[model samples]
Target: MKLDEAKQKFVHSWGVLGSNWGINKTMAQIHALLLVSEEPLSTEDVMEYLKISRGNANMNLRGLMDWGIVSKEIKIGERKDFFKADKDIWEVARRITEERSKREVEPIIKILKEVKNVEDDSDKAKEFVETIENLESFTSKLDGIVKKFVKSDEHWFYKNMVKLIK
Candidate 1:
């Protein structure tokens, strides 16, 4: 298949799959473009190909870099910085797992901790506290699982997580 056709399919698929992972479609699409490209691409090239504005390209590129999937590259003798996405799917997944743990899981744990510590003794407060404590337990277990997966070199974590959910 031609690069354009392949890239479009990838972008579309990634955009569709992105929502479940807490990333928006456009961001995923931009990442998909970089991921499949053989050469590093500048923001201007991305904007033109994706038909998005400069700001949109910039914002999404930064987000991809934050997720550790896309990296900025400077070509020799070229002033404009280019972006390249990670070629390994597993590395992408692992980076995403780490980032999601930090973004979604960590804050939830903090909230659960704070809520469980509330000093109210009323029945409603008691219920709230009990619920929060339970949440804290579950979230803590989740964090533990994520930590275990991140430490290991195996792919079983993702499979086990899916199993755990099922």
Candidate 2:
């Protein structure tokens, strides 16, 4: 296939994968477009290419920036803003992992900590406390692992992953 065809396919596939990972399809598609582009693209360019509205493009671009994967590019003497995706795939993965842990895992852990502290002596309370404790234990471990992965260099993390796979 041609380069354009391959890029379109990749963008579509990435959008689908991003939805599976709990991101909006349009946001993922915008990220995909930025990732594959050789140069930074303006919001107008993105909207035109993706056949989306200005509001939709702008909203998703801001969301991507919040996720720390996409960034705004300010050009000299340009009124409109351009955007680019971090080209380093490992860095992108690390940022996404960190963000997901913050947005999803950390909040759940906080709620578990709060709710597990109920002061009662009934059987249902005992079972509830036990369940919450187990869940807190598992989530804490998962959070620790995610933190370690976020802190470690890509080489060390991948090396350990390879060893585990082998």
Candidate 3:
């Protein structure tokens, strides 16, 4: 593929992956644009590059910022805010992992804990509580692993995991 085609393919693929990861496609496209950009982009620039509406650009930019992967930049003698993405791929992946864990995993653990507290004296209730407890245990283990990954360097963590598995 040509350079431009490759870039377009990357952006499109990243957007699709983001959708699968519970993020909107446009938001991922915006991030992909910023990731490939040589300089920071203003909202207008992003809208123009992505051929999106001003509102769409602004909303997705805000979403990326909230995820801590996109940040605002100030150019000297310029009033307009430019945005840039965290160019480090590892950092970007780590931030997304951390955010997803906080948003999805933590709430699930809380819900499981609450549901496991159903106090009743019947086989059905006992089975329900037992299932919930098991789920809670599994989720808690995953939560710990995610937290550890979020806090540790990717290479170091994966190396240790490999050693443990071996």
Best by lDDT: 2
Kindly report which residue stretches of model 1 are placed more than 4 angstroms away from their true locations once superposed.
1-3, 155-166
**How well does candidate 2 match the true structure in TM-score terms?**
0.96
Clashes of each: 0, 0, 0
Candidate 3 structure quality by residue, lDDT tens digits, 31-122: 99899888999999998877999999999999999999999999999999999999998898899899999899999999998888876989
lDDT string for model 1 (1-166, tens) is: 9977877998889888987667888898888888778899999999998899999999999989888899999999999989999998877777888888999999999888876877778999999888888889999999998888777665676677789899
Clashing pairs in 3: none
TM of each candidate vs. truth = 0.86, 0.96, 0.94
Model 2 regions lying over 4 Å from their true place = none
lDDT of 2: 0.96
Q: Return the lDDT, model 3, position 122.
A: 95
Off by over 4 Å in 3: 164-166
Better of 2 and 3 by TM-score: 2
Q: What's the residue-level lDDT of 79 in candidate 2?
A: 99
Q: Give lDDT tens digits, candidate 2, residues 62-104.
A: 9999999999989999999999999999899889999999999
